[model samples]
Target chain A: FRKRQPSVASLIQGIRDGDKTALSRAITLVESKNKTHLVQANQIIEACIADKKNTLRIGITGVPGVGKSTFIEVLGKYLTNQGKKVAVLAVDPTSSLSKGSILGDKTRMEVLVRDENAFIRPSPSEDSLGGVARKTRESIILCEAAHFDVILIETVGVGQSETAVHGMVDFFLLLKLAGAGDELQGIKRGIMEMTDTIVINKADGKNKQAANLAKIEFTRALHFYPPKENGWVPKVLQCSALENEGISEVWQTILNFKDATADAIYDKRKYQNKFWLLQTIEDNLKMQFYEDTAIQQQLEQLTTLVMNAKVSPFVAAEQLLALHQKKLK
Target chain B: FRKRQPSVASLIQGIRDGDKTALSRAITLVESKNKTHLVQANQIIEACIADKKNTLRIGITGVPGVGKSTFIEVLGKYLTNQGKKVAVLAVDPTSSLSKGSILGDKTRMEVLVRDENAFIRPSPSEDSLGGVARKTRESIILCEAAHFDVILIETVGVGQSETAVHGMVDFFLLLKLAGAGDELQGIKRGIMEMTDTIVINKADGKNKQAANLAKIEFTRALHFYPPKENGWVPKVLQCSALENEGISEVWQTILNFKDATADAIYDKRKYQNKFWLLQTIEDNLKMQFYEDTAIQQQLEQLTTLVMNAKVSPFVAAEQLLALHQKKLK
Candidate 1:
C-alpha cells in the first residue's frame, strides 16, 4: 500500500470519505514543496471543493497570551456541541521567524483538539504578507470536503499589519484586554474601521468592571465607524474565554450576522476570490519585475547614479523603462 | 524679479536667511516635476544637513475629527511662545481620494500661522509612503538650517500605514479622545507599542471623568508593553486640545524625552537613515527587475504555466532566479 503513490484523485476521494489523514495530506499537496504535485493539487482542489456555502470563516487575532487559543478552544467546543463540526486552523506567524511554532497554542486548545466533532490544524504563516491565505483557503476547502460545517482561522496578531488576514476572511474578530484603551491611539484607524467585530477577552475577575466599561465605550465607539458596505454592523462583545461565559451568545451573534447578510456573504466571497486572483497575479508580476537578470546590471548602475546624485530617481526609472522597452522589441 | 530664474544656491541662501517664500520654493524644488532639480536639491541638502542637528522632530497622528489640527495649532503656539521657532508640515493623505486638501490645516492653525516665530506648510500626502520621506526629510533640514527649534509633522491618522511617519520622527505622539475609549479594540497594538506617548485630547467639559478614567486605564495597560529598545518608556497624558490645556506639558514631555535619550539619538538617526537608504534601493530594484526584457516574457509565460499547474510557484521563482544569475554574468 505504501508503494502506491498518493494521487490527487485518491486524496479527494479520501476527503469525501471523511478521512482526517487524507484531509491533512491534501492540504500538504496544496502547500506542496514538489513542483510535480502542483498539477495534481490544482486538479484535486477543483474536484473536492464542495459547496463551502454554510461554513463561517472567522479570523481570530490578538497579541500573544491574549487567550486566542483558549477562546477558540471554548468557542469551538460550543459550536460542536450544537451539532456542528468545527474546524480550527491556528496559524503561527512567528514560526517563520523562529523555525517551528512556540507550539503552545495547541496545548492551550486541548479540549477542542480532542473533540470528535472538531478538527484542529495549526499552520505556519510562512514568510508571505498574504499570510496563510494560500494554504488556509485550500485547507478550508479540504475541511469542507470532509464535511466540517464551520471553520475558524486563528492568526497570531500582527500588531498593525493585519490586513493580510482581514482581506481574506469573512468575519475578522479582534480580541483585546481591558485597561489599554489608550494603546488604541497607536493603531491605525483604517484597521479599526475594517473590523467586523471586536471582542474584549478576559472579561472576568477584578477586571470585570473595566471590561464592562470597555464594552459600553466600544458600543458608542462603533457608532462613529462608517457602516461596512455590506450593511452589517460590527458588534462589540465581552467574553470570558477562560470561564466560557457568553460563549454561546457570541456564537449566536455570529449566526445573526450570517442570517442578516447571507446574500452579501456569497457576493463578498466572490469578490474576495477575484481580489486574491488579481492580487496574486500582480504580486507575482512585481516580484518577477524586480528579480530579472538582463536589467540587473542596468538597475545596479541606475541606483548608483541616483545615489551619487548624478541623476534623479525618476530619471533612473524612466531610463530603465526605455532600455527595457527597447530590449523587449 | 519674477523672471529672476533663481539659482538653487541663492534659493538655499534665501531659505537660510529665514525667507518663507524661499523655503516653500525649496520644498517644491525637492518635490519637483521637472526631475532635473533633484541633483541641485541634494547639493543643497548636503550643504544644509551639516551643523543642523538641534531640531526636535515630533510626529502627530489621530483619527479624523479627533482635533489633530486644533492640537497642532495650540502646541505650535506654545512652542513659539517659548522663543523657539517652529515649522509645521501638515500631511493631507485623504487628498489622494478627494484630489484636494480638506479644511486647509494651516488656516485652522490660526494662532500658529500668525505667529512670526512659526512657519506652517500644508501639503497633500501624495504618494504618502514615498512623498512624505522625500519632501519632509528635506524640509526638516531646511527648517533646522533656518534655526527652527521644533519641527512638528502632522500626519493624517490612517492606521497600519501611520507608522511610516513614526520611523522618520524623533517622538511619535498618538492622540485619542476622552470617552471614545472603546474603538481601541479595533486598532492594532503594534502602533501602540511603538508610540512614545498617548495624549488624550478634548479632555475638558463633561468628558473630564471619562478622560481621567482613560488615563488610569492607559497607565495600567502600558505595563504590558515591552519597553522601547531605544530606552524610551511610552507615557499616557490627558490634554484638552480644544481648550489648549496641557499643550505646554505635551511639548515639555517631548523635550524631556529628547534630554533623556540624548546620547542615543544620533545613533538612532544613523540607523534610520541607513534603513531608508536600503529600503529605497530594494524598492527601486523590485520595480526594475520585472521591467527587464531579458526575462519579462519568460516570467509572464511561467505565470500561466504555474497557474495551469505546469509548474509550481517555487519552481517559477527558481527558474527566474537562474535567468537572473545568468544575466549577472
Candidate 2:
C-alpha cells in the first residue's frame, strides 16, 4: 500500500523550509489528472502565493543537435556556483509521443543532477501543449516558494513550443549551431524577434571561425529589427558547452539585461500573468465545448460538408454552437 | 416607408443571373446583425453553395502609400481586358477606428470602379476582424455565384488583416515600395513566410534602379526559405502601377503559380474551410463567455490580484470559469 499522503498544511510548511521532496510532490500534484489531487494542488498553490521570492525565469531553445542539454547543465552549474538555487524544467508537447525525448534521461545532465543546489525535472509527457505549459508554469511557483532563485525552462526550437515558452520567461535565449552557408535558414520566422540573446554553441575546435562569422551575421541582422520594447538590444555570443568555456559570460549578459530592464521585468511579468489567466480560461472553454459527445458527433459531418463547400463554415459553426447550447440547457 | 426586401429565392436567382444590385444586397444581408437578415443570409448562402465556379481569390497587402489602390485598379483593368470579370473586396479590421482608411474612397479606384465588368466594395467599417472576415468570406461565395472569375481581396499591411485575408485567398501577394535604407524593415515577421509573390511597385523613373535592386535582394532572401509544402517557389517582380507597366507580367506570374499548384489549391481550400469552422466556433465561445457582466466585473479584480502575484493566474482562471459556468446553469 502507498504511504498516506501528507496534508496540505504539512506540504506548505515543508515547501517553505525548502524541502525538495515536498516541492517534487507538489509538482506531481499539479501535473496529476485526478480531481482530488488537483484540489489539493490548488490549495497548496494558493497558500504559496504570498511566498513569492526574487526569481529569474529564463527560457532556452534550440533545434535538435544544438547541445541544449549540455548548455543547460553548464548554465545551471554556473548559477548554483554563484549561490543561486536553480530549477531546470522543460516544456515539450511532443514528449508524450516521443516518450520524453528531452530531459527524459538523468544522464543528460549528470553533473547538474548531482548538484545539491540544482533541481531538474523532465518534461511532463501528458496532455496538450496547454496542459504541459500550465504544469510547468505552476511548478515555477512551487520552485520559487521553495526558494529556488533561478528557473531555466528549455524547449525544442520546433513547433509552437517556443512561443509558449517565450510567453512565460523573462529572457529568451536561442542556441544555434554553425553551418556551412545556411546559418540563418534554421531560424524560424518570428523567433528572431522574440530572442533576447543568441548563443552559438560548440564554438570550439574547427567550428570556431564559422561560429564567429555567424555571430557577426546575426548581429547585423539584429540591427535591422527595431529595439525591443524594453529598449534592450539583442546580443549574439559564442560558447562551447562541451568545453565549459564562455559560460560565465552568458550569465554576465543575463545579469546586465536584468539590471537594464528591472522595471520592464515587473511590468512584463504582470502582463504575462494576465495573458495566462485569459489563456487558461479560453483553453478550458474550448476543451469543454469540444469534449461534448453530441457536438463531436455533429462536428464530423459538418466538417465534411464544409470541406466539400456544401455548407458555409460560419453557418456550420452556428449549428454546432446551437446544438451545444441546447444540450447545455 | 421602407421598401420590401427581396425574398431569398428571388435574390439567389438574381445573383445567378449576374445582377450586381442583387449581389450587393445579398452582401449587405450577410453583414447585418439583425436576426432576420442573418437567417435570410444563411438561406441565400446555402442556396449558392452548389454554384462554386472556376475562380481565383488573390489577397493583396501593402503598407500605406505603397500605391495599393493604383496597383489593384491596374490589375483589375488588366483582368477585365482579358475577358475576366473581377470583383474587389477589402478586409480592414481597423476600418471601424480609422473610418475605413483602406478602400474607403471609391475615387481611389476611379477607373476600375467605372468598368462594367469590375465590382469594388469598401470594407465593412464595423465589428472585429473575425466579424469582418466572416462577412468578406460570405461575400466571396455570393460573388462566385454571380460568375465573377477573379476575386481581389485588398488589405493594409499594418495589422493581423494579412493573416485573416491569407486564410481566404488562393494566392497571397505583398506589394512594396523602394525605400532608402529600410526596405526589409517594413516587412513584418511571418508575412514573408505566407507570401507566394512579392511585387515591387512604383518601379518607374528614378526609382527604377532601386526597385530592381530590391527585387534582387528579395529574390535571394526568398531562396533561403525552404520551398513551400506545395512545391512552389516564390518569385519577386517589379511593376510600375503609375505607368501601367509589367501589369500583364504580374498576371502571367499568377497564372503560372495557378498551373503549378492546382492540386495543392484544392486541398488548401478544404483545409481552410475546416480551420474557419473551428475558428468561428472558438471565437463565438469566447465572446459569449466574456460578455457576461459578472465575468467582466470579477475579471478586473482578479486581474489586479494575478498581476500582483497574490493569486496564481491558473487558480483565478478556475474561479472565473466556475462563476461563469454557475451563471450559465
Candidate 3:
C-alpha cells in the first residue's frame, strides 16, 4: 500500500539488524514485477551475493507422503540441537486453495516451526515446479545473506523438470519409503542418477526388516549409477521420521557428503547460477521475441498456413527472422 | 555369406504363398531409406496396414534389477502355453558399443528366445525416447500383422522419459523391488501418475513384511491419485519373479485392466495416435522449411545479429517474415 518509499534504506537497515522477516519481504520486493523494484532488488542482491555463496543449499523432494514435513521437523531439530542456524524453505505444490498436501505440512511441523534456532517458511506452489513456489531460489540467496547455515528446499513432483531443484542445490537427497515394492519400477533412472543421498523412511518397529532390505536393494542399484566426479556414491539409510530414530545418522551422512564434496561446492554453485542466468535469458528471448506484439500479428497468419500444411512453422520462423533482421538494420 | 537371389517368378509366387520370411523381408525393405529400396518397402507396408492393428500391445518397464526379464519370460511362456503367440521387443539405450544389446538381451531371456511359440528381438535404442530402437512402434504393427497375439515391449531404464512406453501400450506395468528404501522418493509423482499397475518384485524370503508394508503405502498413495478417465486405478501387488509366483495373477490383472478400460480405449488410442501424427508433421515441417535453400541465407545473417544482441531475435524474425510474406504476395 505504501508505494512511495526508500526500500534501499530499509533493506540495509533490516539486514544490519538481522531481521528474517525483513529479509523475506525484501526478497518478495525483488521478485515483484514492477520495473523499478527489479532494479532495486537486483542492486541489493548483488551487494549480498558474495556472502550468500557460502550457505549450504539442499533440495529435498519426494511424492506427497513419505513424511517430508516430519522429516524436516526431525532434521531441523537435530541441526539446531547441534547449534546450527537452519532455514526450512518448503514449497507445497498442492494449490494453497485445495488442501492438497499429503499432510497439513506447516501445521504438522509444529515443534521445529516453533524452534528459536530454526526458521520455517512454507510457500504455496502457485502451480510452479512441484509447487515449490516461485522465487524461492532467489529467496534462498536472501536467506543465505541473512546467515542461515543450512537451507532446505522441498517441492512436490520430482519429474525431469524437477531437475531445476538439482541445479540449485549443493547436495540432493532422495527420501524413500521403507519398502518401495518393485523398487526398480517405482523410480526412473534419470532421477536416481542425480541423487547424492537416498534415505528410506518408516524404519521403526515392524518396518525395520523391510527398511533394511530396501537399503540393501538400493545400495545394489546405486552401483550401476556412474560415480560422481568427486567420487561420492549416494548413501542409503533407513530412518523413522516419527520415531526420530536414524535422523542423526541421516544428518551425519549429509555432513560426510558435504565434506567429501566441499572443494567442488563453490565451483558447482557458481556454474549452476550461471546456467540459470543463461536459461532465464533464453526463456525471456522466446517470450519477448516470439510471443509479443510485433510477432503476434504474423504468428496468427503463420499458424493458419501451417495448420493447413501450406507453409510450415519453420518457414514462418525463418521469414520472421528475416523481417526482424531487416527492421534492426 | 551367400546372396540368396530369388528368381522373379518365384518371388511373385512366394508373395502369393504368404511366406512370413518374405513378408518380414518386405517389411524391412519398406522401412529402409535406400531410395530404391524405400519405394518397395513403402509399397509392402502400405499394403499391410490393414492387417497391422490387431496386435495386443503391452508395455513393460521397471528400474534395473526389477526382474523385468524373468517376468517377461513367464508371461511369454503363459501366452505360448495358452496356444497364443507372443513376441518381446526389448529396446536397450546403452550405446551400440555395448556389444550390440540385440545379442545380449536375447541371451538374457533364454527361455523365451528358444521357444517356437514366441519371438524375442532386442534392438539398440538408436538414441531416442524410452530407449527407442528404430521402427519398434512400426514393428509392433508388423508383428500384429504376422499374427502375434501379444506384443510385449520391455524397455530399459525406469525414468521420466520412459513414459514413451505409456503411449504405445494397451497395458503399462511397472516393476519395483519389494522393499527398497528409496522407493517412494525414486518413484516420483510423475511415474506414479503414469503407471497403470505397480507390481512389487522380489517378494520372497525375508522381504515379505517389506512387501506388505509397501503394498499398504502404495495403496495409500494411489488413493490420492485421481482415477483415470478410463476408470482404471493402478493396482499394487506383490510378486516374486524368480519364484514364478503371481505371474498368472499379473496377467489376470492386465486382462482385468484391459476389459475395464476397453470403453475408454478407443478415445485414448485415437488421441495418442493423433498426437504423434501431428507431432511428426511439425518436426518434418520445421526441418524441411528452415533448411530450404531460399531461407538459409537470411536465417544465418539473422541468427548472428540476434545472437550478438545487436538486433533482437524478435526483430530479426520479423524482418524474415516480411520478406517471405512479400514473396507469397
Top TM-score model: 2
Q: Order the numbered candidates by TM-score, best leading.
A: 2, 1, 3
Error of 1 at B74 (Å): 5.6
Off by over 4 Å in 3: A1-22, A39-52, A58-83, A95-127, A130-134, A154-329, B1-54, B58-90, B93-134, B145-147, B152-167, B170-329
| lDDT for predicted candidate 1 compared with the true structure | 0.70
Candidate 1 lDDT by residue in tens digits, B141-168? 7777777888888776554346667766
**Reference-based TM-score, model 2:** 0.95
**Would you list the C-alpha lDDT of every candidate in the order shown?**
0.70, 0.90, 0.65
Task: Give the clashing residue pairs of candidate 2, or none.
Answer: none
In model 2, what is the error at residue A325, expressed in angstroms? 0.3
lDDT of each residue in A229-303, candidate 1, tens digit only? 788889888899899898877888888888998877766766565555545544554454556566676777756
CAPRI-wise, candidate 3 is incorrect
lDDT tens readout by residue for model 2, B1-329: 75688889889999999999999999999988899999999999999976867899999999888999999999999999988999999999988887755777999999999999998888876668998888999999999999999999999855688999999999999999887855677678678789999999999999999988888778866765545879888989999999999999899999999999987887899999999999999999999889989899899999999988889999999999999998888
Instruction: Give residue B275's lDDT in candidate 2 (0 to 100).
Output: 93
Instruction: State, as a TM-score between 0 and 1, how close model 1 is to the true structure.
Output: 0.66
What's the CA RMSD for each of the models?
Answer: 7.7, 2.4, 10.9
What is the C-alpha local distance difference test score of candidate 2? 0.90
Per-model TM-score, in order, reads 0.66, 0.95, 0.52
Model 1 clash pairs are A188-B159, A189-B159, A289-B289, A289-B290, A290-B289, A290-B290
Model 1 CA lDDT for position A320: 61
What residue runs in model 2 are displaced by over 4 Å at the alpha carbon? A1-4, A98-101, A186-189, A220-227, B1-4, B98-101, B220-227
